[model samples]
Target: MQVSIVGSGYVGTTIAACFADLGHEVVNIDIDEDIVETINSGTPPIHEDGLPELVGKHAGQDGTGRLRATTDYDSIFATDATFLCLPTPQADDGSIDLSVMETGATQLGKTLEATEDWHTVVVKSTVIPGTTEDVITPILEEESEKTAGEHFGVGMNPEFLREGTAVHDFLNPDKIVLGADDDRALADMHDIFEPLVTKSDAPVVEPDTRTAEMIKYANNSFLAAKVSLINDIGNICKEYGIDAYEVADAIGLDDRISEQFLRSGVGWGGSCFGKDVAAISAAAREREYDPAMLRAAVEVNDRQPNRLLSLMDDHVDVSGERVAVLGLAFKPGTDDIRNSRAIPVIEGLQERNADIVAYDPVAAENMRERYPNISYASNPAAVLDGAAAALIVTDWEEITELDAEFDAMTTPVVIDGRRAIDRRDGIVYEGLTW
Candidate 1:
């Protein structure tokens, strides 16, 4: 299958490379000249594990001629299928702003008007339930002046790829959903994913377009709620002088609860969980439905950073001291700090007028854009030098391996939000949730 992916962001670039690797001729279409040029020159525009190797192998001058990128929307007409991986960024009121995606769809439809070939359009970006069928398909039909089912096939196939492990997750997906309004569109989707399915042996779910969109939201919502629930439990365990990990481990033995998202800490902070949860909760409220549990889960997530800061306050006064912050990325293996728990932790430290120095080998540059005044260290040990208190926000391996670095701190008071470091003898250690 010839696959043309629109919007060469994280999802677009990743899937394009993976599709090419899966033996499909792929062309990624984006408006950004820099991204298109980067991909054309055999490099990835964004940071992701295993992405460079994949892009290098299939694109550019030295690689196979299976994958490439272009800035023209007309490029989609040359392909048999197009996946809309454009952004659906969140609005201030928690609803997703679909203006960007709508513009892309309109352009795709205009370019698609010239093609007589039966093309399948798949919505791979995360959107609300009726977005694909109602918003996208209507725009496509209007711009192209062609009927949806008869002229062009429409489908909704949401992506579940995580930030750090996008390549691994795409190649080894838990489930593959193929959604379509018609049989031809569904069959085309199967043809596109058949090779991947045969290799991974993942289950295939056939559903309508609306159900597929809802699945993405529901999946993230459940995991976000689970994390908050565990954090909530951890808070209670702390009040009663209990080890939250022990309680979590015992409960994890049950098949129903499982062990995933059981590690309770500062809270989940990334592009997906918080955005998806908020969007879905707002969507529910728009229908006059009060999703109390979901809203409460968000509230718990919001307060966890303050809770971690309060723990640090009990150990020492950091107002006039050098406070070292370890790990600024939302998680390990990525440079994204969009909604990192470290943001709130840093904000709390700022409120108290703590002289801050933070370290994350990969994400320091990105965080520098957010906090130019604060000091950034070249290494974790450097960040801990002469610090009064150290706050662990991300559980990066380098931050976790600091057994004796605490001795460098003036106060030697360590407050861990992610339990990155263990409690040792030489330093006063505090774990946010044990």
Candidate 2:
């Protein structure tokens, strides 16, 4: 099967590579000239484990003539299946700004309108319920002048990928969900993914489009809520001087709440949890329903950054103080900083008039782009130089090497946001809520 992935993001690139590895012809379309050029030269634009290797292998002469990269819309229409992996960024009002997704779909519609060949449009981006038939299909019909399932079929196949583990997750997905009203569309998608699923023994579920959409939100919301719940428990334990890690250990043994996203920390950041939870809460409110639990979960997570700030304020006066933040990205595995807590925590300190110095092993390059006012350091120790206190927001392994060095400081104060540091002594270490 020939597949065209419309967006060359983390999800899109991995999907294209994985499909190409399975002997399917995959063309990735992107507007970025640099990215398209990079991929055309048998290199991935972004970093991920096993991605560059797979992309290089399949895109190069060794594996398949199947994988290719392009910016041409004509190339996109040439495929039998077009996968929408575009971004559905959030607006300020918390509603998902489907502008990018809609624009891509509309463009695809125009292409399909002019094309003579039949094709199936699959949405691999995360979207709210009813987006497929209600929002997406209408645009396709209006632009294409043909009804869906009559001329071109449609389906919603949302991606579930972690940034660091995207390639592994794609090659060995827990499940492959296909949601389409048209049997032909579903069968086509099944054929495309059948080999990979069979090889990995992954489950292939054929749920309704709306159910499939809801599943993505439900899964992310549950994980976000669980993390928030654990953080809230950590906050409560902080008041009573109880170790949240110990408490989590006992709770995790219950089999009901196994140890995933249960770590008490400065809260979740990155692209998915924060935006998805807010968008979902907003979507629920629009439908005349209140998702109180989800709302609270978002609230707790939002407050997490400030909580770390308050913990830092406890150690020393941040006003006119030199403070070093050890990590900038939301997590250790990637350089994505869409909604990183480190941003807010740093901003919160800045509001208090602290002289900020920030460092991250890999994310510093991107963080420097996002924040120009803050001081950029060469290493963790460089950030800690002449600083009154250091905050460990992200638990990158390099930050742990400083545990002994930080302990030797004359006035060392380390605030662990993710509770990644605990046993280091001599330095004034404060774990936010733990």
Candidate 3:
């Protein structure tokens, strides 16, 4: 299979490397020259586990040269399939802004205008239902001046890769979803994923294009809601002096309520959950349907940070005091801080007029772009020194072993959001939902 992926962001780069590793010739096309060069140099543009090794094995001068990156849209003409991995960022009104996808589709259509061989364009990016058939198909048809199913095929193959473990997830997926109306498009998708399916022995889900699109949104929205529900239950458990983890453990014994997404803390904040939930909610509203439970999930998640802040306030007066934030990334293993809970925690501390010192193992640089005013410490101990209280937002592996760092703090008050710390002898530890 010859695969061309548009956009060299996290999903794009990861998939391109994985495809090449699967013995498919892959070319990643992106507008960023630096990203293209980096991919061609056998280094991943983004930080992901096991990605560099795969990219290095198949790309670059020393490798097989099966995987390479280019900025030219014309490169798609040579590939049998092009995956549109562009970003669908949320607009101000909560609907997805598909301008990036639209532009990519237009350019792809123009590039395929002169080609006679049948090509398949797969929508790998998450979008609202009806977007593929209604929005993207028309743009491609208009630009190419060719019938979609006859001349070119379109398919919707939603990715189920999670950050921090994208390579493992891709290779060992739970299920493979193939969405297309036409037989040719469906066969092409199956052919592309045949290697993965045989290797992973994952279930294959064959749905219509719209259903596949909805599957991605529904999948993310449900996980977000589950986290919020656990957080809500965790909040109530805290009021009655109960350990939420214990409750989660017992409930997880039930076959229906699984153990995943049960750990409640400051709530989920990443590129997928918040944006997908918001987009789906907006889509539901557009059809004159109110998604009340989804809206409540957002409310519960939003209030969790304040609840953590209030717990901190109960122990110490942070006004005109120094506070250390232990983690900045949404979750450990990556430096992405799109909708991290630490943002609200920091903002709440700012409203209290506290001098903040933040620390993250790898996400400080990214968070610094959003908050350049806050002081960032190189290590956890540095952040704790002279600080009145500390809040743990992310559960980095290094944080779980910080037993002696509290001794340096002015006040050894710890409010753990992810339960990533222990209640040391000298430290007053307060778990968000314990």
Candidate 4:
């Protein structure tokens, strides 16, 4: 299969690499010349596990000629399918702002107008229900001046790739969803993922386009709400001086709950949960339905940072003192800080007039761009030296394995937001929810 991927961002770049690795010829289309050149030169533009090796293997520089990149939509005419991976950022009203998707659709439609060959367009980016049909299909039809099912097939194929393990997840998905009204589009989608399904033996789910779109929202919202529910229970456990993890462990034995998201820590902060929940909640309101559980979940997650800070406040006054912040990325195994819990922790430290030093194995530089004035340490030990207190935001392995670093702190008061530290002698340890 010859595949063309639009928008060489995280999802786009990752799937392109995965497809090419599965023996499909792939062409990545992007507006940025630097990104295009980087891909063609066999280098990945982003930081993800197993990405560099894939790019090095199939990106055409080594003469395998399985993968390449271009800046022109003209490349789409040559491929059997094009996956729309454009960004659908949150609007001011909490719905998805489709301006980027619209622009990409317009360009794609214009490029299709020049060719008579049949092509399938799959929406890979996350969007609310009715977006692909009510919003995007009309734009593509108007620009191309062609009937959708007859000339170009439209489909919705939601990606379930998690950050930090995107490649592994895509290659080994638990399910593959193929959503399309047109039979040809659905067939093409099956052809696109046949290699993966054969490789991983993952189940295939076929539904209408709208249901597929809602599936993504439903999946994310449930996990987000589950985390929030556990966090609430953990808060209660903390109030009663009970161990939350022990409670979580006991309840996890129930097969009904399954216990995937029972780790109640400083709450979830990443590209997916907050935006997807807000979008779904806002969409429900637009339809005149109130989503109470979703709203409560968001409220619980939003209050977690303040609770972690309050725990720190219980120990020592941080004003005019050095406070070590141990982790910046939203979660470990990646260097993304889009909605990291560390952001609010740092801001809280600033409000208390505490001088902050932070450390992460790969995310310190990224966080530095957002906060240039804070001191970034070369190692986790560097952040703890002579610090009055330390606040743990992300559960990076370096911070989790710290058994004696508390001795270096001026005040051995450690606030554990992610349960990254153990309770021991000679130091006061506080878990965010324990």
Candidate 5:
């Protein structure tokens, strides 16, 4: 199968690389010349685990001449399938702005108009419901002057790859969902992903395009709900003098609950959860549905970063005090800081006039680049010197393994935002929502 991915971001890169590894010819398309050049030069555009090595191994290989990068619109017409992996950023009204998808669809439509061969365009980017048929299809049809499902079919195939382990998740997906009414489009998809399905029992669902588009939002919101629910429980436990970690452990033992995303922390911060939940709730409101619970989840998740600041104030006055922040990324194992809780936490402390020094194993460069005013030291210990308080925002393993003596601190205070640190004597230890 020859596929053209229309974005070179995290999802696009991983999708292109995975398909190429599976023996399919893939041309990853992007408008940026630097990104295209880096990919063509056998370098990864984004910093991800095992992605650089994977791209290095297959980027220029002739046998797997499968994987290539380009900025040309002519390549879109040559591929058997065009996967739209463009960004659908959140709008001011909290709804997903589909302008990027619209642009991609319009460009592909122009390519379709100029070409003679047929192709299937799959919406792999996370989009609002009905986008494939209601929004994108119309543009593609209007620009190309061709009927969908006959000349060039359209489908909704969302990607579900976690940032840290995206490559592994892409190859071994939980399921392969293809939403298309056109038989030829469905057949083309089955032929492309057949090897993956044949290797294991992967369910393939063929729902309406709207249903498929909604599934991505629903799935991410549900996971975000789980995180917020646990954090809410943790907050209740904090007020009632109980350990939220223990409560979660007990709840996780239940066969029905299943302990994924139950870890309580400063809250979820990434490109997906924040945007998806907000967009879904806003969309629901537009459709006359009162998504109170979903909105509450978003509120609780938003308040988590400030909760850490309040915890700091309750324990000690951070004004004019030296503080050491242990982590800067939204989570461990990735340098991505989009909507990270650390931002508010750092800003809140700074507003209190605290002298802050932060350290993150992988995210220091990004943190420094984003917040140059704040001091980003080389190591955790370097940031801890003469600090009155130590706060952990990201649950990086090295911070938990830190053997620094608490007696060396001016105040000996440690606040765990992710509950990563255990209780220790001689040091005043407090955890967020714990």
Candidate 6:
């Protein structure tokens, strides 16, 4: 299969490299010349675990000529299928802003007008239900001046790749969804994922386009709710002075309540969960339904950072003190700082007049954009030195190994948001919901 992916962002770049590695000739199209050049040069434009190696092997000058990138939308005519991997950023009121997706689809349709063979345009970006049929399909049809089923097929295939382990998740998925109304479009989707399905022995889900879109939202919303529910339970356990981890471990034995997302802590903060939950909630409200439970989940997530900071305040008055914030990325393994809990933690620290020093292995430069005046240390040890108190926001692997660094703190007061660190003898350590 010859596949072309538009918008060389995180999802677009990742899938293009993976597809080429899966024995398909792939081309990545992006408006950004730097991203196209980076992909063509065999270096990934984004940082993901195991992605650089895969991109280097399949694309670029030093590897197999199976993958390449271009800035021209006309290259879509050369491929059998094109996946719209553009970003659907959230609007101010929580509705999805589809301007990017619309623009990309129009450009793709205009390019496809030159091709005579039938091509499948798969919606790979996460969207609300009815977006593929109501929003994207009409634009593609108008721009191409051709009927959808006869000239070009439309499909909705949502990606379930996590940021940290996207490559592994792609190669070994639990399920593969192929959503299409037309038979040929469904077949094209199956063909694209055939190798992954066979290798991973993953179950294939065939549903309609709307159902597919709903699945992405429902899946993420459920996970977000689950975490909030656990955090709620963890908060109760903390009131009773019970160990949340111990309770989580015992409850995980039941098949009904699995251990995944059970580590009740400072709540989830990332691109997917908050955005998807808000979008679905807004969609439901538009339909005259109030999603009370989902809104409560959001409330719980919003309050977690404050609760962690309050615990820090219980031990020491951070005003006019040096505070060390460990970790800035949402999760370990990636540099993405969007919706990271560290943002609120830093804000809370600043409100108390605390001099902040933060450290993350890869996220410092990105976080610098958000708080330009705050000091960033090259390593965790540097942040701890001369600091009065420390707050652990992200569970980076290196943070768990710190033992001697705590001794350097002026007060040695520690607050663990993610339970990433173990309690030591000298420091006054507190877990947010232990």
Local accuracy by lDDT, each model: 0.93, 0.86, 0.93, 0.93, 0.86, 0.93
Mind giving the per-residue lDDT tens digits that candidate 2 earns over 109-189? Answer: 898888878899998899999999799999999998998998889998978898878988888888888999899899889
TM-scores for every candidate against the unseen true structure: 0.99, 0.96, 0.99, 0.99, 0.96, 0.99
User: lDDT by residue for model 1 over 335-433, one digit each (tens)?
Assistant: 999899999999999999999999997999999999999999999999999999999999989988998878999989998888777787889988888
RMSD values, in order shown: 0.8, 1.6, 0.8, 0.9, 1.7, 0.7
User: How close to the true structure is residue 120 of candidate 2, measured as C-alpha lDDT?
Assistant: 94
Candidate 4 residue lDDT tens string, 1-434: 99999999889999999999999999999999999999999988888899999998998559377889999899987899999999998888888889999999999989888989999999999999999999889888988999899999999999998888999999999999999989999999999899999999999999989999999999999999999999999999999999999999999999999778999999998889989999999999999999999999999998999999999999899999999999999999889898899999999999999999999999999999999999999998889999989999999888899978789999999999888888999998999887
Identify the candidate with maximal lDDT: 3
lDDT, residue 262, model 4: 96
Candidate 6 least-lDDT 10 residues: 107-116
lDDT of 3 at 127: 94
Model 5 error, position 312 (Å): 1.3
* Per-residue lDDT of model 5, residues 1-434, tens digit only: 88899999999998888888777889999999999989887888887888887788779653346688999988876689999999999888898888888998899898899876778888898988888888999998998999998898888887778888888787778887888868888888888888778865678888878888888888899999999999999999999989888888889988899777788888999899999999989989988998998898999999998888887787789898899988888888789888889899889988999998999988888888878988888877788888888888988888888756556788878888988878888788888876
**What stretches of model 2 exceed 4 Å from their correct place?**
60-63
Task: Give one digit per residue, the lDDT tens place, for model 6 in 226-340.
Answer: 9999999999999999999999999998999998999999989879999999999999999999999999999999999999999999999989899999999999989999999
What candidate 1 gets wrong by more than 4 Å, as runs, is none
Candidate 3 residue-wise lDDT, 346-392, digit = tens: 99999999999999999999999999999999998899999899999
After superposing candidate 5, which stretches have Cα over 4 Å from the reference? 61-63, 405-408
Clashing pairs in 4: none
